[model samples]
Target: MLIALLLAVATVPAGQMFACTPIRVWDGDGPVWCREGPRIRLGGIAAREIDGSCRRGQPCPRASGIAARDALVRLLGGARGRSGTGHILVTGPRLQCRSTGNAKGDRTGAWCSAPRIGDLSCAMIATGTVLRWQRYAAGHCR
Candidate 1:
């Protein structure tokens, strides 16, 4: 019994170690979406609410998808001029969105759950002509 208990205790910490980091949608324009494993992040229709409803009569902006992709690439520390892809270590879902006012008006947005320590695709809504992003480290659970 003593040997069994000791072996179990030794394995606990190793089991807790995560292989993948949680990546959550921070913010973006259009219909923002993401996928894990061969990660593909895309921006969809521009919406005014959390449910992703495209505003009526609002034409898709030429720079919308570019803006979203730019935000993700910057967070991952990828090259500005190159369009290649690579893996990024994202640990949590703590994200925020800020927007620059365009000729029309200021945009608004939000995200769902906080990221967990696992593989996931994150997506969110964003407003403004310009979008900014920042990365945060995640804490271990007790």
Candidate 2:
């Protein structure tokens, strides 16, 4: 019964808590993958706008965003730790994001670290792939 109770009260839905693995990723300030639901976009802090570019030339989009996403994949992959795990934990902000229809629809999500690897956002920022976007909240990335 303990296991049943735990599952019932889980902060995240049981299927997501245990099954929201990163089969794919994208370049959001923080990216969310698809599973059986919409997650990270609903709960994670936006790391950087993939649409924004660092420089403005003829069609010049800042390469930084792509770099950031690549870094995110690398970081997440490195920390994927075990099967069906490594959800990134975005604990700083709990604000609502704009309702944009990304390749996947918008939804709520949970953030966690790759097993024994550490936080994905912090790692990406530290490595210079991402920077703090200060338009959303008043905290770390504020």
Candidate 3:
């Protein structure tokens, strides 16, 4: 029993460790994938006109309907494409972050392909750490 207890204790720390996981972001309206890179654009559109807050749980909004795509592209440095996709596996204390989606009709509720650390998604943004746009896949916007 002593040996078993020791083994259990040894594994407890491992359980606390959080590793980055691969996540996929799909364009809400279609199969298009958001992209990442040095110069990102969404549907060949520049991100200059995009608008919205970067608060955790808040859906990143844009002037055009393509805010989500543009935000992702800018944060991760890539373009929003129909088939372009990338992953930002979070690690360490950042494991608290999570991906989220917007509820229909609410701009702040839009889906986050990759959230910061400790944020979750529901009809509304949760309390705690918030996430900024950061990562993308490849493909054209709908």
Candidate 4:
């Protein structure tokens, strides 16, 4: 069942709406694994890599990678556990997301809104844990 869900969501066309229940969060900017099977990279923002480095030419916030990641976990209802592969499990509300399309690798690029958190990308930036990356952001952060 899960594999079927994954395969179905593997190619979300741009501007499509999808539901997400965040199960694990990898960082402030995301790769937020959803129970519905898509891995979402929060559209319009960038955070430090796990090693505290930003990709070249991207907007880099001053916060460390761990700090940024922890902030996101909290916003997503906090960490409940950790997956064996090191992803931090969370307890966030289901999100309503609009796919911008597939991102680098297998993740989807999307703008997601949580019940209380509103826009995940804007929320992350409001906290200063991440920065808006214009190239991919496409004015979504405004």
Candidate 5:
């Protein structure tokens, strides 16, 4: 299933191409959106609200949302830095992703991530605080 998901990502045509530049991470669950090309969502998982707290029962951090955002930045930063040439082609869901960003109102966008490193939603889930969103997943954990 994972392999199938990975293969779904759309790529550049025969001769044309675009550079995956610095992605400005959004304040919420979104890693903002990629630039110069296709927009993607970090499939499965959704980020905690910027002001959203951790699990209710436990004593969460002062700014858990910020931490998640930072973690995402670090993850993407590492991947971006590793590449010294053209675009990184960070793979992402080619389906359902909004053709353009509309964060504030309708909140329609797709998730994405760096090559071989995996998707941002997965990384955030590995953090233990986040889980796959119910809307896009079959059970809970994919």
Candidate 6:
């Protein structure tokens, strides 16, 4: 349906600027589904996976997956709602992001910023729910 359509057009190339109105979050370093047809993974950071496990070689923060996910939900204008299927419905402001290219699977890794929120990657790190993932930071996680 609509989700399939969004996923199909989700490949935004690296070094491009794009609009994203986040509607759903899937964990901290996300597959944040945007209304304009992109799934973004917040660049420059990493958080625990939903199962509370950190993949080998990834930065492991001292927070649980739920903690990280909730922090991200709050930053994105707070959760409007949530689902049992790990999808968090959010009401965040529209974001402008610069793509760093594909972030595995169907997500684009990007550093996103809104007017009042600033850079999402930095904000997420500030919450201490995630950690700077140097591999993808690319000098942007300040």
Q: Which candidate number would show the highest lDDT if scored against the true structure? A: 6
Flag regions of model 3 displaced more than 4 Å.
1-24, 27-62, 84-142
Residue 59, model 6: lDDT of 97
Q: Residues 35-137, candidate 4: write the lDDT tens digits.
A: 8888899998999998999889888889998888999998999999999998899978999999899887889889999769988889899888898888888
Candidate 1 residue-wise lDDT, 1-142, digit = tens: 5334423331212112111122433323322212221112121224222233334655333344445444543443333242133223333343222111121211112222223312111323232322222221122110
Estimate TM-scores for all models: 0.24, 0.47, 0.23, 0.91, 0.49, 0.91
TM-score between model 2 and native: 0.47
- Angstrom error at residue 33, model 4: 0.3
Q: Go through the candidates in order and give each one's C-alpha lDDT.
A: 0.28, 0.42, 0.25, 0.87, 0.45, 0.89
| Candidate number that wins on lDDT, 2 or 4 | 4
Better candidate number, 3 or 4, judged by lDDT = 4
Candidate 5 lDDT, 42-123, residue by residue in tens: 4456555566755454334344665666566556653332234322323222222222233234333444445644555666
RMSD of each: 15.2, 9.5, 15.3, 2.2, 10.2, 3.1
lDDT of 1 at 36: 20
Name the lDDT value of residue 57 in candidate 5.
Answer: 40
- Quick one: ranking by lDDT, best first? 6, 4, 5, 2, 1, 3
Write one digit per residue (lDDT tens) for candidate 3, span 7-60.
333121211222222122223121122111011111112222223333354334
Q: Residue 54 of candidate 6: its Cα lDDT?
A: 98
Task: Supply the global lDDT for candidate 3.
Answer: 0.25
The sequence of per-residue lDDT tens digits that candidate 2 reaches over residues 3-108 is 3532343233423333244544556344454342334542223444455554232222234665666666665553333233433322221121222233233443
